[model samples]
Target: MYTLILVLGICAAALFLAGFARGLRNAVIEYRRGKPEPTEVPDYNYVGMAAISVVISATVIALVGVAPMWIYAGPLMVLGTAAGIGVAFFVERPSA
Candidate 1:
């Protein structure tokens, strides 16, 4: 039973690593193929800018000891949510 579990764990780890390596390899290939194309810059809307600015302001405030946890937390969450939804606008799409 122990041997079986060990073998299965090794197999799972190997498969996971192989898949991760393949993804990195594909990303490199796609990046190389995309080099000739013009990349679109991610434009920040007011809300996006506000989120980023809030985070920056919070960090600066923290350096001054005037910031609370929520000061950073709220802005970080805002940026995190925005990044989740808007990452496609920034990243290069691989050519078919």
Candidate 2:
């Protein structure tokens, strides 16, 4: 039961973070599109941010003693990031 809950929680968090990163990236792209000089707006690196989120999230869970680091961290970081990014890519951005 505990393992199931933990897995679900981590999956949910990963999905949310990935979606947020995508949304933020889209917003930045749109913002830059509207600008006369796109170079003026700084670029957003979603991949780096997503990777950081995955690592930090796993670290926090391990530090909190919720589960052993080996149990979920490594596999979830890879799986979660892949799955999350995949899902985010499929989701359609809102019509501007």
Candidate 3:
């Protein structure tokens, strides 16, 4: 069970990275095309991001030997992912 969790965590991380890369690529393409703004990511991107959050949360719980994994892990993952997404957007935004 633990091994399965770890494997899932790794896959989730990979998927997050891939989605991030894809979003970035599309943003760049739009910029190069002189579009006024980058396109919003689709629902699938959010799903991928959510998967990553859950995976990270699960990994943290497993590493710390915590019980009731959902209690702490879920909120932490949500907060962490939100902050991460904000940072990504801020960094990628056009400078005034």
Quick one: best TM-score, which candidate?
3
Question: Model 3: clashing residue pairs?
Answer: none
How many clashing residue pairs, candidate 2?
A: 0
What's model 3's lDDT at 51?
92
Model 1 steric clash pairs: none
* Model 3 alpha-carbon drift over 4 Å, by segment: 38-96
lDDT of 3: 0.61
Ranking by TM-score: 3, 2, 1
The candidate, 1 or 3, that scores higher on TM-score is 3
Better of 2 and 3 by TM-score: 3
Candidate order by lDDT, decreasing, is 2, 3, 1
Which 10-residue window of candidate 1 scores lowest in summed lDDT?
83-92
The root-mean-square deviation over C-alpha atoms between each candidate and the true structure, in angstroms, is 11.4, 8.7, 10.1
Which candidate, 1 or 2, would have the higher lDDT against the true structure?
2
Global Cα lDDT for candidate 2: 0.67
Candidate 2's error at 57, in angstroms? 30
